[model samples]
Target: MASNIDKYKSDLQKLLKLGQQLYYAMNYEVFEDKFIKNIRTVMNSDEEVTKFIKDLPDFDLKYQPWYSESLVLIKQLLPDRLGDFIKYYEKPKNRKLLESDNYTIEDYLQGNIRNQSFKIATSVGLDAALPQFRQQLSILQSIQARFESSLFDIRQLVQADFFDSELAAAKELLKHKFARAAGAVAGVVLEKHLFQVLCDHHIAIKKNPAINDLNEALKKNSVIDTPQWLFIQRLGAIRNLCSHNKINEPTPEEVGDLIAGVDKTIKTIF
Candidate 1:
């Protein structure tokens, strides 16, 4: 399984290539046929867009023009483009004559409207009605540049030193086949980090919190959504089982899930 960072980098590159293709093709079909088909898979979802932007390295650098421009486009422009294209135009190529209507008397009579429509249409289709293809490509290009610089900011893919002690220790424990202990440590890390999330977001917290308490606080404070909150609630059970009952040993598989879940959860909140 690739880490989230690796997946983010991979998807960013793919979106970049798709943008270049759309730009050169200069046709609505590029968007209708290829770009739309893949963008959702590439970015996962709108929620993940916020995650990707947040996760990018050097996110605060002042000099990356593409990075900042892309941020604005992603948040503001690409969304409307994604929503309505051919459908917004509300007409299909098949409906129109294969050729222009023989330069009809009616067309000559209404020459100004005809001329504008001609500008809107190209050798392709009624692309004049919309230029979402261009908009999509523009945003993809911004995302590409941002990711490129950010990757450099973070250095290599395996930046284990970037992690805090508990997280790093849990990884080392897993490497040494200490699955049960790793599971416990991961639980502690999850709670501590969720606590940190509260502090970072300025959410009110009670003294000496449990996982349930932390998870609920996160949800109530709008730090995490319902689905994520629910998933971590299950992680809370695994943590409790591992920490509270010495005799009820967690399986390696369960511990592995615990580790992965906590890792992703923390990254998302951050």
Candidate 2:
């Protein structure tokens, strides 16, 4: 079985390769004609141009899968770059033709724009997208530069995959009206995540720490700020109601909130 670090390294490399392919695709669309023209004039040889063209790696980008996966990783690891990374991809809601209505890569990928026209060039969005892809690639490269220290990130990513699966199971339970069971499942996820966070911060664990105990430990150690501390405290209360309280049944709505809250906390806190 591949260890978490190896899995993380592989994932990062895959993202980097996909990003490079996407960049190549966009670059080819934008400058292939110019490149061929320049190379033909400079080399004055058809054989050389044919060889160059053949050497270019063939790539057909299924943009959404790469974009979605990279977006999630950027949101987790390098959140400051997330906005710009998204800006180049998501289509604007209100596009003013003469104003700030620049086309996006999404428009090009979705076939919403022309290949060549008198109005706009096929490279309309490449200007924005190429730099963004480079930036995201840089983010991955920097992470790869320091492999050992990134184990924490790898652990978080690995745990995130498990948490997402468990939450999906909880969602299925909720859909069947097993509200208490769903809440219990969500509460367990939250508790397990909190324990993991404690371990991440190297906090000493007590025997059988409850959600409240873990929350308090995190708060007292200044691992979480006041607002986050209070938020976890509220989650602990909801978890208690779901796990221990036996009088009133947990509403689907409340259990839904618990599941959603757990999801957010697990994604954000680490």
Candidate 3:
């Protein structure tokens, strides 16, 4: 069985190949009369004429788009090109015939519009679709060229988003006067982020490492200098104060500082 990444690559290649084939099929329909003219000399027999006028395969044009999967990957990996990719496939509203008919790639595939003859005649059948599909194919190829690296970046992006949400939740807790709870939430984010950083650097650590443990490992591995190590130690102390020191409640200021420090550490360290 192929992995999702492998499937994604295969789908991209298939899309490009199929897009090219569809382009050729569309052109064959548009210039079919010209094809007959060029092959007139060879039409000596019925067999020759039949061979020469054999229908081109337009079945491939009905390819069910892998849109659901491709769109998700596009949003995550090539977000900048996402709009254009969608634009090429969807029917544009208030479109002019001079610009384009309301017809789109979807219309072409669904048989809602014709590529041949006077019925549903338009110059922008697959011509409009092919150019933009080629652009999308190029975008997919760029991602394929650096797939592993792009995956790593995606992991980092997802983690960063999670960390941001955690911090926001921590802030909401602090606003409700639950300083200890806020610090704990912030502490978890900091700890998880450090763990990820260690894994990224391939540094060995225990299954259940403390914030200080992760911090010390990072410092020992030279991932962070002494100053950063000291800063993290201070942040770790505040986390301990909030988590373990039930006798003394953490101040709002201390929890606020801890959250801010953790936010900075995750962003700067990684």
The prediction achieving the highest lDDT against the true structure is 2
Q: How much is 66 displaced in model 3, in angstroms?
A: 40
Candidate 3 at residue 177, lDDT? 99
Tens digits of lDDT, candidate 3, 1-270: 454456556766775565555554655555666656666766787678566445444534343454544665575556667787787677666553422434556655654434354344545544445455555556666666656573445566667777888999999999999999999999999999999889987999988999999999999999899999999999999999999999999999999999999988876784
lDDT of every model, 2 decimals: 0.57, 0.74, 0.72
Index of the highest-TM-score prediction: 2
Q: What shift in Å separates residue 122 of candidate 2 from its native position after superposition?
A: 44
- Model 3: per-residue Cα lDDT at residue 117: 42
TM-score of each: 0.49, 0.51, 0.46
Select the stronger candidate by TM-score from 1 and 3: 1
- Regions of candidate 1 where Cα sits further than 4 Å from its true position: 1-11, 22-130, 143-177, 196-202, 267-270
Write the residue-wise lDDT of candidate 2 on 1-270 in tens digits: 564457667887898886776666666766888767776886758998787666554433456777777776666565566777787667777663412245566665654534443465443444454564566567656666656563434557677778888899999999999988898898899999999888977899899999999999998998789999898888777778878899988888888888999998996775
Please state the error at residue 47 of candidate 3 in Å: 71
- In order of TM-score, best first, we have 2, 1, 3
Clashes of 2: 0
Q: How far out, in Å, is residue 36 in model 2?
A: 20
